[model samples]
Target: MSSTTNYILGVFDDEDEVLHAVSEVKSKGIKIDEVYTPFPIHGLDTAIGHERTRLPIAAFMFGTLGMICALSLISYTMVFDWPMIIGGKDFFALPNWIPVTFEGTVLFTAFGLVITFCISNNLFPGNNVEPLDLRITDDKFVMAINLDKNKLGQDEITKALKSSGAIEVNVK
Candidate 1:
């Protein structure tokens, strides 16, 4: 028999059950860490009481920061910082700064946003993941709670899951 780990928390049998359980849990004011599903479920976000993600805002801010940095660096280097006369033109010329500034801005912005995204998703080069269940990724739904280290009442959570329409429940 495959032994389930304590950190595995609780698993609910199906997607609908998981959704209902999430709603019920939220109604009881019990905060859930995360809900894993095989596929997208309509109204799942609301059921889990998840707020609108701030990822887009973070990406926008990072991109904007990158744009400003790139623009300033290019602009300053070509004009004030270390002005260089090129093609018999004025060192502080505006038109000539456009191409480099635009390119740098685009490059830095894309990189900054992408790096932020990777970091947020925990997609580093090598990372260990603790998946609650295989079926949760394929067909079932899993709800995990980060209880205060062996402080969880398994029976209570099991009862809650069943009451919320869990088709079946498991410790892992």
Candidate 2:
């Protein structure tokens, strides 16, 4: 089945106005699909009712995996496979393994985080997603409301946006 989705965009020139508009619109029991801004705004996530992200947890898990892999490789190569006795030390030398293990952990963590972020955000190379508004990337702050997701009529939503200092409202 093919279905069309409609979006109502509220454009604001100032960050403060957009922030205020978020609260004003939410107070009227409207659901916002997403907000686009030129730069990060402090406390905007909380204002928009977004939950805390679990990226830190994902980072820790990836780091742990890296550490395990590094340790395993060092143990196998140095202790079991080659049995190297460098600097008159034992085959399983902990001190010598420090540098390689650290490097491996850093490398894996860096790559893992990049892959995780890209996958989570659906950002892939050559993906041609259209922007809601070109000015949103430069100077404008846009609050997009999915018309199909909310029970309120378009006229009411538009009125709420206009009342909340929106410079312009457009439907797409």
**TM-score to true structure, per model:** 0.66, 0.95
Per-residue alpha-carbon lDDT of model 1 for 1-31, expressed as tens digits? 1234353344666667777778786665556
RMSD of each: 4.6, 1.8
- What's the TM for model 2? 0.95
Those runs of model 2 whose alpha carbons end farther than 4 Å from true positions after fitting are 1-3
Highest TM-score among the candidates is held by which one?
Answer: 2
Which window of 10 residues has the lowest lDDT sum in candidate 2? 1-10
Q: Write the per-residue lDDT of candidate 2 for residues 1-172, one digit (tens) a residue.
A: 0126789999999999999889999999999988999999998999998999988888888888888999999999889998977889999788888898888888888999999999999899997778878899999999999998899999999999999999999988
Specify the poorest-scoring 10-residue window by lDDT in model 1.
1-10
